[model samples]
Target: MDNFAHLFQGFAIAFTPVNLLTALVGAFMGIVVGAMPGIGSLAGCSLLLPLTFHMDPTAGIIMLAGVYYGNMYGGAFSAILLNIPGDAPAVMTAIDGYAMTKRRKAGKALFAANLASFIGGTIGILILTGLAPTLAALGLKFGPAEMVSLLLLAFTSIGWMMGDDPKYGLISTFLGAMLALIGMDPVNGQIRFTGGNINLYSGLTFIPIVIGMFGFSQVIEMVTNRMSFHFLGGEKLSIKGSLLNREEVKGILPNALRSGVLGCFVGILPGAGATIASFISYMTGKRVSKKGEQFGEGVVEGIACSEAANNAAAAGAFAPLLSLGLPGSGTAAVLLGGLMMWGLQPGPRLFTEQADFCWSLIASMYIGNIICILIAIAVIPFLTKILKVPAGIMAPIIMTLCVVGSYAANNNIFDVYVMIAAGFIGYFLNKNKYPIAPLLLAFVLTGTLEKNFSQAFKINGGSPSIFFTKPISLGLLIFMVLFITVPMVMKKVKASKNTGDQPG
Candidate 1:
């Protein structure tokens, strides 16, 4: 009952003239950014993070969250139109969406994507509204030991995300931790790895590194590779209808709802993000649909599965961050960093201490997603036009943005150089199939992980046994061990199977 009242008040806050305008503008920009290949929500939010410095924190976060959700909606555009996903999460969408486009029902495919996005997004936010508060309330019971264990669980779980090789993920995670250790030690107040450089005291800025990696790295790759695109239909990619028919809607709504639930569940997990959720949903949709055989053949059910699941996952990824100070995904790690920059700490205290801000942010999500659906439909012509914009033009623009964003954060020329260095490192790391997500997220969460670890140790008189003594911390540590070890065991078993099958 109290939560509902708070939500209503949050609606009032979100609808305030300035906040509403900000949401609308951010939503529009986010979609445009996301429609650009390789620039996912992280790139968009990181690039724009500095702009939030001058605004109120609540409004700033609201706008960024809007961008976060809008990107998910926008990613489907290129997937359907150009057979190229704007971001990884949309790769599944491309499977059936592009097929539909090839079948000359691009309009229907576009409509289904947008509709699924709206449904999934709405469900996600609603789930957030319901789950966040409960989790926040429960988080009130946590001690420092539990906090440390929880963060450890988050780190270890997310570390296995590197495709096919968990060791690569672990290496990336350690690098992030090492980077996070570069600044002054929080407990000792002594610089650990600054090498006497004055600029290293405050630590490496998260935004510049993120922008350089996700934004500049891609631009560099494109420019170097001189990437080119060839649209099947050229500049005249046209569609027949903009709105979904009743029968199509009926067929997909149930699946959309099911995917929404699945996506939200996946999102609630520490590192299971949109890509995993979308693939899982697509597979599930294929298994049960009467038109299962036609899934990859332009079926609307396929679009519904992918779009709904990913969008819902995007929304679902917020729960842990808002409630427990633990990020839900790689992008959520960036969002968590942004919150820290604004002097806000995510946790149970956040909801109680800043009810207006948190609730309003949640309220704004509904509005933002509604706006995204409209933009997805009404802007199809304009968006498809964006698909024609070549990589040559885009590369320079994104590179420029990365440079400016890097220099703008602290007005330090050194940061720009740092960004360039990070860009090179990131490019090489990515080229070698190392997962950047664990590194980025590890960097973001490492500071808190250390802080909680130190505090928990002190409280226990420097005895690490407290971690195992407490039930919450013990369970969390056990989970972390399982998460890290199970994958290695599975990989070994698979390798042995393959070796046995090989000829001498």
Candidate 2:
């Protein structure tokens, strides 16, 4: 009942005319950002963060949340029309979405994407609203050992689930963890890997690394490959013309809901983000569909599942941040920093002390998602026109944005260098089919993993058994083991069944 009252208060704040207008404006700007190749929610938010300096903190946060969810809707445009994923999470969407477009069902694909995003995002927000307080309370009971084990579980899951080859994922994770270890030692206050470089004192900024890995790297690839934009079957899509048919809606609804739930759960887990959510959703949708054989050939369910999962994952990414002050993804990390910048600290105390702020943010999520849906439907024609722009002209623009985005993060030139380096590394990794998601996951989770592990060790007198001593830790460990083992077992069973079914 108390929670309900708080939510009503939050709705009052979010529903104010000023805040509502900001939400619409944020959604508009977010779509523009997401439509541009290599720019994502984090970059969009960072670029706009300074603009919010003059606003009330609640209003500022509402706008930022609007941008966050709006990007999820806009990301589908490029993926379907140009076969270019505007964000990393949209990669799965492009695989089938573009195919559907090529088959002259571009409108249907786009419609499915938007509809699924709405469903998934709404469910995710509801889950966050209902479960966050409970989760926050649970977080208060966590000692160092539990935290450490949880991070370890995150690492293990990312390594196991992210790539075609687990080894590549593990290696990427190790590299990220090593990079995370560079700056000041957590316990001893000693500098570890600086090697006399002054910039190493504060460690690598998350913005620089993210911009380097996802943003600059994409620009480099476009430049090197001389990639050109190709519209889907030369078709122009309009809002009114893009509604899905009854059959299409019936086919996609189940998968969208299932994937949304799954993605939300995955999003709440440490080190797992939208990329994994989309991938897993795609695979699961394929496995469950009666017409599974038609998945990559432009199936609507594919687009529905992938888009739904990624959007849900975006919503899910907020759970840890709202509940425990631990961000689940790079974008969330940026939001976390923004919170601190605004002199607002996140955690248990946040819910208790700033009930209106927390619930208002949640309330804004509902408003933001609705605004994004409306904006996406209204602007489809304009966004599709972007597909017609020649790559020769677009390439430079994207590169410029990459440079500006990285430099804007800290107003530092070194970040530009980092962006270039990460771009080269990402390009090679992509060429080699090595998953970058694991590296990103590891990079995001490394600090938490290290801090928790160290604290757990200190609390338990360096005893390894401390991890298993707690029921929650033990259960998570067992769950991790099952997560790793079950996939292999299922693969073997399917192979055996296939062999048995073969004609002699």
Candidate 3:
């Protein structure tokens, strides 16, 4: 009842003229950014984060949240129209969405994506509204040792669960940790790994790295690959043609509902992100649907499951960000930085201290969700036109944005160079099949982990046994170990079974 009352208050705040306009603008820009390939929510938020400095914190964050929600809706546009994913989460959408395009059902795919995104985002926000405060209360019980263990578990999950190979993910995770270690030690206050360079003392700026890796890396790929697209039919993209029939609506409802529920829980997990949620939801749909065999064969269900899950996951990620100061996804990590920059400390205390801000943000999500769907549906005709833009033209525009966004972060020329270097590194890393997500996640979390580990050691007179003595910490450690080991063991068993089946 208290939550409901607070939510009503929040709605009042969100409905204020300035906040509402910000939300609308944010949604529009987010759709444009997400419709462009390679510039995901991470880069989009980073690019626009500088603009937030001029506005009220509430309005600024409202805009970013709008962008986050809008991006989830917009990503499906490119995947359906051009067969290229606008972001990582949309990759699953392309598998089925593009197949629909090939069959001259692009408009239907766009409509299904928009509908599923709305359902999933609504479910996620509802769950988040109910769960975040409870989770924050629960988080208050965690001690330093427990925090350390939990952080370790998050790191382990990122390394062990993401991408095709755990080895590559782990390597990426370690690289991020190594980069994070270059600045002064947080506990000791002693300079380390700076190599006497003045710029290194303050640590690397996150926005530049993020913009380079996600934004500039894509530019590099576009220049090198020079990919082209071909649309099947012009009439198929009309808004009238995009409307779903009764049977189609029924088909999407169950899949979207189920995936929305599943994705929300997945998003709450410390390191499980929208990409993972989408993949898991799509796979679940494949296994459960009656027409499972036709999953990748231009099926509406496939698009619904993938789009719904990713959007749900995007909303669910806020639970940890607000309640525990832990980022639930890559974009959430960027938002975590924004929270700090806004002079608001995230975690359990934030609920009690910043109730107005918290509830208003939640309320705005509902508004943003509605705004995104309406805009997505209304702009469907124009969005298909975006697909006609050539990669050669798009690459230069994104590259210019990347350069400007990076430089604008601190007004530093040096950061521009750093962005370029990171872009090259990211491009090579992707070319080598290494996942960049774990790297960025590790970079974000490593400092927090170190702080908790230091606090635990100080409390226990430098004895590591503090981690084992606490039940929660011990359980978390055990879970991390099992999480890493079980996958390897299963893979080995499967390989052995396959080998045994082959004739000697």
> Which candidate number maximizes lDDT?
3
Q: Give one digit per residue, the lDDT tens place, for model 2 in 1-504.
A: 777788889999999999999988988888778765557777777888888888898888888887887888877887776555666677667767867765666777778888889988988888788887565355455566766665666677666655667787788878878888888877777888989888888777655566566655656666776623343226566766677889988888898899888888767765567766776677667657765557767888888888889888888888788768887777888888888888999876898988888998888888989888888777767665554566666666656766776676667888788778877887788788776656765665687677778878888888878889888788878877886798799989999999999998
lDDT score, candidate 1:
0.77
lDDT of 1 by residue, 187-262 (tens): 7788889988989997887656765666566566766766333333344444444567899998789889989888
Give the lDDT of residue 435 in candidate 3. 67
lDDT of 3: 0.80
The parts of candidate 2 lying over 4 Å away from their true place are 1-16, 30-61, 71-113, 128-132, 141-147, 162-164, 185-195, 205-235, 240-362, 493-504
Clashes of each: 0, 0, 0
How accurate locally, in lDDT, is each candidate? 0.77, 0.76, 0.80
Candidate with maximal TM-score = 2
Q: Lowest-scoring 10 consecutive residues by lDDT in candidate 2?
A: 227-236
Clashing pairs in 3: none
- RMSD of candidate 2 to true structure, Å: 5.0
**lDDT minimum window of 10 residues, candidate 3:** 227-236
Output the lDDT of residue 360, model 2. 88
User: Candidate 2: lDDT of 336?
Assistant: 86
Query: Model 1, stretches more than 4 Å misplaced?
Result: 1-121, 128-133, 227-365, 380-384, 491-504
